[model samples]
Target: MAEIETLQELYVDELKDLWSANDQMAKALKKILGQATNGKLKDMLQASQDGIAKHTDVLKALIEGQDEKLKKEHCKGMEGLVAEALKHTVEEAPKTGPVLDAAIIAQYQRMTHYGITGFGTVAAFAKALKLDDDATKLEAAVADMHKGDDLMSELAESAVNVEAVKG
Candidate 1:
């Protein structure tokens, strides 16, 4: 662990944590897609996976631009989130149909909120450090996460939650 004595160091370390979170979520999402019975949910998950890949590459570029190594610190928080998702979506909850879809959407929104907060924090840190370009990129990432969260909410309200109650 790089001893973070300065804000710059802390920012980079936080970026690495976020990087790890994105990668972990991407991997978990592949499994999630299989569990999704709804076509729209499956499609949204696919798009989200693609977005994660793109954002991860952007983060790597930002880190490398700062002359920092593009290494990832394990994101334990996301690990727990993923575990919780699995418990609800796989272990304790229904295996398929609308019920699982609703649970998956709930878990996905929770995870997206984490990304939104993390990216927003990094953007603030970058702004404070006068890294305007990095701040812009991070803010863009935050926007993207917010949009994804909104999409999940729309899907839940329009279909998943209703079907869940009926079925």
Candidate 2:
């Protein structure tokens, strides 16, 4: 981690954290996708992974622009989220079927919500620093996260939760 003194430094730190979070989520989603029994859920997770990769690239560029090495500051919050997700979706979740799908969805949303907050804060930090371009890029990331959340809600209501209850 670089020495962070000003709000701009804080912004870069947050950006680094988000970079780590994106990487962690991308890896977690792959494991979760394998565990998921629902085809729609699998597709959604795949799409999210693609988005995460793109976002990671953006974060890397920003970090490098700060005269710092392109590296991630371990996001402890994301680490915990990933651990909890593995517990639910891999270790203790049902072996298969709608019940497991429900668990995956639940865990996935937890991660997505985390991204939403992190990205939103980064965008706000960029705006506060009067970096409009960075802010716009970050806000776009936030929008993508919200879209994922919305899809999860739709899947839960229309299929996943209903099927899960029948278990």
**Overall lDDT per candidate, in order of appearance:** 0.89, 0.89
lDDT tens digits, residue span 71-152, model 2:
7789999999999999999989886599899889899999999999988998899899888888898899889889989999
Model 1 regions more than 4 Å off? none
Worst 10 residues of 2 by lDDT: 62-71
lDDT of 1: 0.89
TM-score of each: 0.97, 0.95
lDDT score for residue 10 of model 2: 94
Q: Alpha carbon lDDT of residue 82, candidate 1? A: 85
Give the alpha carbon lDDT tens digit for every residue of 41-138 in model 1. Answer: 99999999999998998889989988987799899999988888777876787855999999889888888888898889999999999999999999
Clashes of each: 0, 0
Scanning candidate 1 in windows of ten residues, the lowest lDDT window is 87-96
Candidate 1: deviation at residue 57, Å?
0.6
